[model samples]
Target: MLHVTTYYDTLKVTRDAPAIVIQAACRALMQLNHPDNFEGREYEAVKIAEDLREAFDVLIDPNTRAQYDNWLAKQMEQSN
Candidate 1:
């Protein structure tokens, strides 16, 4: 599963970042990781692109983002 922590890092945004920030991050990352940009590195690029898409998929949806934020909080709590 794609972790919320990964998404935050990929987007270079804090956990409390707004929806617009998430969307902008996804757009920027997708531009760099898009299949067409990979060329010979299709396999690796595809995987990265998929991860970016999954992150956007969750973060773009308010409910899913909320759930992920909660999950991330719990994960941090346990780690601490």
Candidate 2:
């Protein structure tokens, strides 16, 4: 299986980071990678922004976030 980092990694936040912090990180990343903010790199920027949005969505949902956390723990345990 391909190893993928957790949503927290995608947002560059700690696993225990609060929702407000995660929201701030998401907003900041979106602004930085917004398609309009890039000139010739609009396509790449848009893709990154989309990924950040997806990560934000998962992390913002309590149930999904908990599930993701559990999965991440298992992955880490297996890796070790």
Local distance difference test, each candidate: 0.81, 0.89
- Number of the top TM-score candidate: 2
Model 1 lDDT per residue over 1-80, tens place: 34444677866777788989888888888788787987898898888878888888888899998898898778878877
Worst 10 residues of 2 by lDDT: 1-10
lDDT of each residue in 1-80, candidate 2, tens digit only: 66776788889999898899999999998887887888888889978987898999999888999998898889888987
Q: What is the TM-score of each candidate against the true structure?
A: 0.81, 0.87
Where model 2 places Cα greater than 4 Å from the true spot, the runs are: 1-4
Error of 1 at 42 (Å): 0.7
Q: What is the C-alpha RMSD of each candidate to the true structure, in Å?
A: 3.6, 2.2
